[model samples]
Target: MDNSNMWIKHKNNRSIKEQVDILVKLTETHKKCIGLPKSKREVEFLKILYPASIRNLEIGDKFIGKTDYSAVGFGCVTSTSGVGYFFHKHKIDELKNNTKDKELLEKINLVEKYWCDKDTQENFRKELKKSNPEFFKKFAKNDNYSCVVCGFSRLSGMQLNYNKLLDLGVNGLKKSILSRNKDGKNDFYRASLEALDLFLDIANHFEIETRKLAQSLIGDKLEREEVLKVSNCLKEIKKGEKPKSFREAIQLTWLYGVVAGVVNYGRMDDYLGEYLLDDLNNDKLTEKEALDLVKSFWKMIAWRKTVMNGRVTIGGKGRRNEKAADKFAMIAMEATRINKDLEPQLTLRIYENQNKKLLEKGLEVISEGCTFPMIYNDEVNIPSVASAMNVSLKEAEDYVPFGCGEIILCGKSVGTPNVLINTLKALEVTLRNGYDRVNDVSLGYNTGKIEDFDTFDKLLEAYKTQLKIHIEELAKAQRLSYDVMKENCSFIYVSLLIDDCIEKGKELLSGGARHLGGTLEVYGNINSANSLTAIKKIVFEDEKINLKQLVHILDRNFNGFEEIRNELLNAPKYGNDEAEGDLMASKLHEYVCMCIKESAKDIGLDSFLAVVINNHSNTIWGRTTLASADGRKKGQFMANGNNPYNGTDINGPTAMLNSLTKLKTDIHAGSVQNMKFSRSMFKNHINIINQLLEVYFENGGSQLMITVVDPKELEKAYNNPTNYRNLIVRVGGFSARFVELDRQVQKEVMERTLYE
Candidate 1:
């Protein structure tokens, strides 16, 4: 029978198990057609599958029926018209039903059979090759040669070229082995093996596709030159010697990382050991060599070549020891310093123990205006990570920044793919009855007429009603975006480096990426800060000004009212540890989080909130907001995401965290709190680190980031640009040299109070 006829026949007469069996056979045929290897991780993942009998399934209900299960989680069954039903695991459920025995067994068998098929491995390789070619080429080259760092090289002595290494064969391979034997118990060894295998497969595919595309786009002349350069480098490395120059070493290391990513499931930590500080300090390698390696690796990946979103973490929590400004960090910092190009954006984390010198070095790079590496703080962040994962201080300290500064406990836990909500936007919609007063879009269906609001209480009530409507609409938009991302974008490079994907036979974007669920980051809640502050002064205290007058003042950019603008500024603001401003911020945060929860519940997905005001939100969301009562002018920037307007918080960072703690973190999604400290703050207040950690976990902080700089230095640098060229500050999630950031971002940073 024809292929179409056979597929139709298989679809109709077969049970789910039978259909899976046929599919498995087809997969093997496809694998042979593609010439791919069988992956053990995929085989093991398939063995855990079981069919669940779900009846009368609603849109958001838990997937419950009689089924044998090993993992602790709730599974939901979903079906599109053309696609068959699939079960997605959610929460943990212990109760088991008996009546659906046959259906449960069939489901389990199908899952197992589908995972075990060799075709799955082949399909994964095909997707990786299709998506990322640079990664693949680097991997193939590394596998064909010895260690790129300490291997034989043509540039070495005349006796140590490719011919010599080939002649030595097993001896050369033995000499290249870096790890000592540990009776198969070495975690690093096992991880390396897994990473190596994965890298080879993914990299091979990536290279093939990349070369093809380059040839097609740039023509064969340029493609051949590129290929020859890479080929020559590999030939030199095969002799068990190191590259003669720093640039070649950099290329080799970069290739190694790209390959390691494929094998280790896009995990940076798994490959960190292969290229850490200790390796350089021990005289085994040089800082220039390591830096070159990372630079070359990134250059080859050409992040901009593919349209996929990319994230890079340069500094992590525990990794920030006293000498945090060590050679390794410097290498990563410098690579970013010189290469300000946009691909592979970098994130840098700041901690109490961080080396002052290293911080300055990163600042030097940022002052060049590249907006990287993004800075995160460990003093406040460690406890925040602990709270989110329910772990200990030490365990949380081990957290690493992943997927755009989201904290993930390295090799232990996942906390990404969380839902995001814009709380500030919610308030705006609520206040305007679904009409964005700033944009004048009729987003809400006139839930409450503006004319009916006779009192402040009535206005607030109308705002709350409008907030609920916008929250519902925003959640729907998020789900649609998630669906589109999952279906259209395949994380082939990430799949190789990250864990669980290969084992589960799923791609990273397809619910296989480490962290599941949604996190909403509320923007402009601080706009409510201005609004509430205005209401208290105009409507309640003075009674000389009314809502209408206040609105007009704001609309006119507070023109001809310098006295009123000063009065509004003096009105209580959020993040000052004062009851009036703090309470309003807290109430707004809680109310918005609740709206997100209610709307997200309709889709059977767990929702959380994170207040990430990284960078000056000026570039993305801030460009659109109107002048807020917080003394901001119309078409001017609003407060950074979830952060108070610049220069608004009069109190110190401690007060800021205290005010932030007023919100109910347990009830909402997740939040990102960014605080900046001058280098002087650490001079006599080293103990402040402990205090910061204490209040963060005690007050239910989710994510905390800190930037360390000298306020005097920044001021001088700003005033005399040439004098302080090396000054740097953490802008949002990345660090840039103080002079490097855009004028507005620089102004925002300068406006932040520098504690003594």
Candidate 2:
């Protein structure tokens, strides 16, 4: 029985009256779906909303999906938005305040009354808080920084198995589900089938839109041809047939991923390689044409605007077709070179005895000020990931770095960096005996104060104890979140796409994923390490300043303590390739990684580790973090990711890169090493840049994200934004136009050493 025509007709450009009618219908549908299984109820919601939500195909849009895609998946906060369907209370109130349309406001109120406390976030929080109050209390009390940031929503930060979707197509997926569910009575299977039906129906809508747009633009040959191509690709996929061309493959991948609310597209070249090669060999489309389609795909990606989340991988070992994959990778690099967009965070994975031209092209793009094609060293990462995730090297080969730089085993793992731990704050709380002076609360466990720790080693151990207490609590919150979400939403969409979900006949969070692991995001690691190194050198070794005296000076944020601050600043810094400082950082890194990893079994997780994958949160969190013993002022940004504190790496780029490789990454999920090179120096010297990266990676560097900018150009743009509209810089894990970044983020970027 075909259920595609069961939903009502969609009116995207609806007036106030149409929206009200749709909301009323959804309210009625919600009442009808009350007793059904949770997965089936979710499908019931989408069955109505999918057709009624927005749909349009731009004149030159090569990809079918748009920025305003009414996409949904297993998410906590994303229970509903748009069309005024299931709009949470907060959104409803905001809409009423912002809109002048009285009819729209009435509809919003009606939806809010019907679904005020029924949203996923509200329900998930209510249940999980009962189990993990300490983690929830921080958020409830509005303390954004208590050395840890956690929530019950653990759905984001996962990589969907797009390769499985592309390989199976629509019909194959449905067939597999049916085979698993022989009786056809399973709610997960039923919900999955219904979701597929919605997927097809949505594709049909885009096809019709594309056809109409093609007809209207018949006079313009170029644009008409593009939409028509998209129309044909949509027609093929919606009919459940395998894609025979590259355009068909890309169209299916984008439309499905966008509609499924999946941001990360892992190992694109590995999965889409065969179709790309097949199309090129058969002359179905020119190389330029395929590249244009990818550009359109990038357009849709940038349109989503998932800041620091859209990760696309290419060029690594273990590819079934390395030749085709490499070819696709070169094209992807070219696309990054041409598009100059912030998204899809094009990543290139290089290994031993592989092509170096790809690296040169990536550098060339970076020199053009496109902070993209972030480099990953397979030689270092593969072995490191195998140890970190506790998987075989074969499984680790499927490693894909999702949001920021947290690594998950591509399609097989559920590794979301669910909590953000502030290592520096751990030290701060230990120094003050569990008091968070900045927030004026007892945030961490009451470890002994500075006076009790007569030796530096004792102080460091106390700090570690504080970190462990907070990590276990926050980690328990993460685990309980998964357990709670499993009872409410089946995560059916991802279950269909994620590996072993169908085989296990269970949802993603219900023991379906191969590796049901979690990650904790650790920030201020280098700053904390620097503080320890500085204290070890200036206070303990020299005995010039006692621990209590130093804590007092730090409490004042270095006020009237200029001489002691200078002494701390003059101490050995990590990024200078100094052994004493780097070794301290190494010790702290191993402790945090092993601590988190070892707690996985106790927390009921397969594997839980730390990811120093810093985002803009580093700047935001640093603003509230108190001053430290490392000579940093209070409320100032800490070091971004594993890089040294800004302006501290004076010995230059090579030394900094050398120091970055010192910390072992094998036991942790992932880390980011950001470097900024002066455009004037490296732009004309691509060969030297190539050799430099080669030596760095060969010397055990795991990953690097480089930004090549002209000397003083960031200052030029920051001062006069209108002058440099296209000045892009690497901001932690993502790149953004310098003029568009938040001012503090801009300041942090400006402060990094621009090696010239």
Candidate 3:
């Protein structure tokens, strides 16, 4: 798969030969680990990979951790973690194509041969086939139709505990990891210790290189000064001491996250705030200096290639030091205003009785056409998470949104959205009674034929049956994924930083974390709601056609049935403030959420819930999702998150807000609501925009990702993308520069109504 699409181009790929060197070192080190313990081997590979990594000390860049395209992230074993080893089949081919040296080509071939049958997927297959053949086939089939007909991937969506890391320091964590060791017999302890030691070696190697580079630069005083400062920061952090300044804190967090490939940095202000405040109160650094450090951190986040996963949350209730956090949050918002990049997906959690000036600063940032900080409402989310996760309200304060707005408890749970359920496709397959017309294969559970459904209730039951089966199997997959990861290797870095892992002397997936919960991503939510509503109105309630006739219309892709399609389209949709249609969505949404939560207990998980947090999967999956009662063309993008399908919510923004808030919030992990505003209204009516957000939050809205732009500008930008590289827009859960998106996704964005 071409990963260039999902991930942002965050780093400058080192020259091809240099990349080859890194891969060669990694493979050579990997070969040495053949007879060693799994934990030791993985850590040893990193120790070699680190010193060999290309060290860059660019004049303007402050942060030091940048690796070649060989792979990013901490784990070297699996693509789900970091796609390390840089020796995949395609990569080897590319390397062979580029390099003329027979030696290098042979070395690359050796690397490929080493991992050919020993990689994560291959190992997983051997294990699963031996232990669970039936499930392995099902998992493979799900993968074959991934991101389209609902599937799971090793792509983990989670956040590391920045506060814990900043507070504990390397020494503190080291002591904890070895605390329970008796004669070094514990395998977890030995591996964790080695991993930490090797991790610090990576830092130590860079520190020395940066120092050497700084010493050599005599004429460029500013460059040398900055380079020396970075070298010193690395030295201080590698000494096993907690960060004493804001720069140290941010630098440590960013570098560690880069190595670990752990995106979704949780509550930046909460962790790094006190350090900034200390700097301010003690006159160690001016506000401008601190702000510059933050801006540099933001830039580094964009430069690192996490794409869609670099989430940095700030602001909200239950903060340990609200004043300090607020101050840091304000600075962070200002940084966003200054550096309008797509990464570091800066998010602000808004609440009542909070800092007004901070919010005003956020508005200033947004008014500048920055697609962040995407505002999440704590008033709705806090209570919702407490109930959904069965935790206290105070514990709920730990709730932070991970990849594409899926809510997970920071450092406490591994809520990787492993399973995906396309609710719209659930309806589509139900209509086909188990057949997938687009793929020309019979997939999913057969809930009986259209002729068997005499009433709308029966039709609804069929949809429910199909959903129940898919979600249940996927839940098993979700749990089994962790089990598999645990079998192959211990996620040393992930376990070391997250909660209860060190304390429990176990890896996170191996029962080290406080909460071993999982999440299922639901896509095409509003489109599904609209389709079901249309079906009920046109087929059962209105009686304009029977179930068989409606299925026939859908089977024909609305051909020769344009009139019926129009009628179906005219039926009540979810985004309108209409109670009946909104209620239908609410009912179906509640059913799915509740069913998932129940499945968690049945499967022996601490907690599990559904999330309507969609990335581009709505658009990606919509291509294969057959046409339905929603009036969407067979391959048109599905309704984005819980937002209205494009141009279907004619009752205006207020009504749309009303319809959006109708879905029960407490039952699910999170649901994304995307809203667009015309540039005229957003700029001229800033107060009204503020009120709209406040009222929605106060009612029941959890999160709103707003994109304010002129539709004409979007069109112009789309037509001539090279000239408008700076144009950014919110695309579902993740925001991207307008010109960066594909033509179909661009069209979907253009098709959205820019409400006046």
Candidate 4:
């Protein structure tokens, strides 16, 4: 079919189900044609679509019908618009029963069966490659000769040495391949093939589409000019020469990703180390030069649309070569000082021996509000990861951030795509009989009338029942989306980078990746805190206010009730290690985890938990939620992602960790425990940092993100603002300048108890 005609057909579809079906089919066809399952990572990239696709198909309709069957089988026949109503699963059973098309039913069944089947992935890979040999060949040859950034030639008989490779073992080749493996195979040869295949597919798709998009958007002349610039950069790098300047290098790297189908391939620290070390040794690359290069690199990366989405990690404890990674981190921090852009998101790892200068630099960036370098505490994170996977310290150190802010052992694991459910939203739905103003929708299984409930426990039971209902629905949606993505979008490049794809002949998505599970971050648990506290104080404790009065006050944002607002604020809050607040946090986390776990089992996938209240916390979601009682004025900052509200946890970092330890990690999925330390704390008592981390992890800390900064400096910076422009803090997965963050977030960072 002509491209125009195909697009027209896609746009003209009438039924939402039909539109979804077409999307699924198009995805499957795309994978079958252009996809190659070279590695487990590649497969994972493919399998991640099932939940989203399923949800899209089931959106809006409360019951499944014949149209729903068509949607999942043939693809959606409508335009990709509307309220994402395509994701609702209200009528799944009805659709299954009503569908009379045997062929369509068979296709749906096949998709479902293959969602987690390794053998199916292997077959799909072979079939896809066989269908599009020419495309695959072109994709594979796109990058020839050598490493684009370092000019490390890949020519046969040419001996090459990279410190990164040596430190990572097998010249880093095995580690690179293993890192991409969606299925857990460590063999370099097999993993390489898989990784190569996945890389080629994704790269080719990206390259072709990007070229087409550029041409259409900018006209042929401009497109040609851009292409020429990229081509020149490629040629310059291939000549076994350094760029004339840092700007050239940055431009070259950006062009390389643009043309070569590799996005942000410069492990800057790894690639420029030789030059950096030489400069460091001879005092040739001054701090200014180092900083300029960092700035230049970010500018170039920001120029490219794709590179902006890429991530960079600076420090990892117990990495193949800890010393090298640490040194590289210092260089990266130096660079962050010069350039503070959002692209090339940088992460800094803090351990017992973190460089003080580097910490100051990071804080400087944070003080500027750029929020560039997010911090990770190796003391806590390393052990936490180790305990979760039961891997060696070295393996644990290899952990890297995946989607959102979850940690995965880079070279050795395949964690699930992020699946998020707002716990407070769920509670709201239950309270309103499946209607949520918070989310502006009705989503729940209407089991019965909840008005009959006479007690808080009965109300709680209804909420739990509702939670199970939506969770199960969502799990099914996740499975379907997984299948759709696996069949449509192939992860050729990812596969090549991950381990064991070629040997297993599986893609990353279909259980081939090391960690085979899904994680859901529960939001608005603090809302529950506010609600529970209000209920206890008003109905149970004070007896002066009833449930109606409390709800009325909440609806009013406590506008006329300054006294009540103060009371709620002074009341027990989560993260203070108070029994009332801590118990509520524990109950909410545990109950939510149970729902997710049970629902995940229904879909034949492992369900895990992660607490992500990062950037999303500050953003407005749904109409301003009524004023929360946790000292938060109405529309004030919700709990900082998963962490407690700013200044709420006053006891200390230890008390916060203790509250976290109450929940059983082994039983739940994974949780992120973020702690911010002042620079003064680091210098005065590094051992205290080490001991606290040990105690936290030993007592069941699941995941940790640590930020080191000086409170005095931070407060000073907040007041004066321009004195420290380079301050950085661990903001979720990546780092950012503290001063660049929204004021509320800045307050949150300042409020984190800096351990003494």
Task: State in Å the error of residue 643, model 4.
Answer: 2.5
Candidate 3 — what's its lDDT?
0.77
On a 0 to 1 TM-score scale, where does candidate 4 land against the true structure?
0.59
Per-candidate TM equals 0.55, 0.94, 0.95, 0.59
For residues 1-756, what per-residue lDDT tens digits would candidate 2 score against the true structure?
A: 001111222223555555556666777787798899988887887676665654577666677665332212123223112211224343345446666887777767777677766655456568656766765665443234534454435465556777778778888998998888898888788889989988898888878878888899868998888778888888888897677888888888877766556678889998888889998999887899889878878877876566667889998888889888888888888888899988879998988867777777777777887888898988889999998888999989989887778888887888866566778877887889988787788776788967888888898889888888877776786686576667666766767778888888778888788889988888888999999999887888999899999989999999999999999988888899989888898999988888888999998888999888777767877887888888898988889889999999988888999999889988899898898888777877767777788789889999999898888889999999999998888888777888988899899999998878
Pairs that collide, model 2: none
RMSD of each: 18.7, 4.7, 2.5, 15.4
Candidate 2 global lDDT: 0.78
> How would you encode candidate 1's per-residue C-alpha lDDT over 1-756 as one tens digit per residue?
000110111112224344334434433443343432222322212222222111111112111111222221111111000011122121001111322456545544444454332222123334434554432332122111110000010000000011121223322323322234236453233333443434333334334433454355455575455554443444444333545433334333344332212111122322343335455656755766566566755554332221111345445455433242255566666777676544354555556555566556655655454455555556656765565444588866655554334445443333333223334444444445555564444433365654566576777677676556545544543454345334422323234333444344454445544433444445567766567666766665788666667666766777898787777777888878888887777777777766665665685443333434343443334444445666666555556545666787788777877777676654442345566665556444656754774566456554554556665667777778887676656555444567766677677777766666
lDDT (0-100) at residue 388 of candidate 2?
85
- In Å, residue 5's CA in model 3 sits off its true spot by 4.2
| Best-first order by lDDT | 2, 3, 4, 1
Worst 10 residues of 4 by lDDT: 147-156
lDDT of each: 0.45, 0.78, 0.77, 0.48
Instruction: Write model 4 residue lDDT over 361-459, tens digit each, in one string.
Output: 665654444455655556656765665555677766665553235555554454443334555545544555665343344443454454555566776
lDDT of 3 by residue, 1-756 (tens): 112335433343576667777777777777777688666776776676665553566668788766554532235223223432223465567777888998878877777777676555445446556765654554455443432333333536557887878888877788876667867887778888887777677778788888999999999898899999999988998887899988888878877776665656898899988999999999999999988988988887777656567788999997889999999999998898888998878889988889888778887788788889888888989999999999899889989997788888887877777677788887888888777776666666778897888888888898899888878877876776566666656667777777888888887777888888888888877788788888888888889988788878887899999899999889888888998779988888899898899999876788889988767777777887778788887888888888888998888899999998889999888788887787888889998998988888888888888888875999999888888999889987888888988899998888876777
Ranking by TM-score: 3, 2, 4, 1
Cand. 1 TM to true fold = 0.55
The local lDDT score (0 to 100) that residue 214 gets in candidate 3 is 96
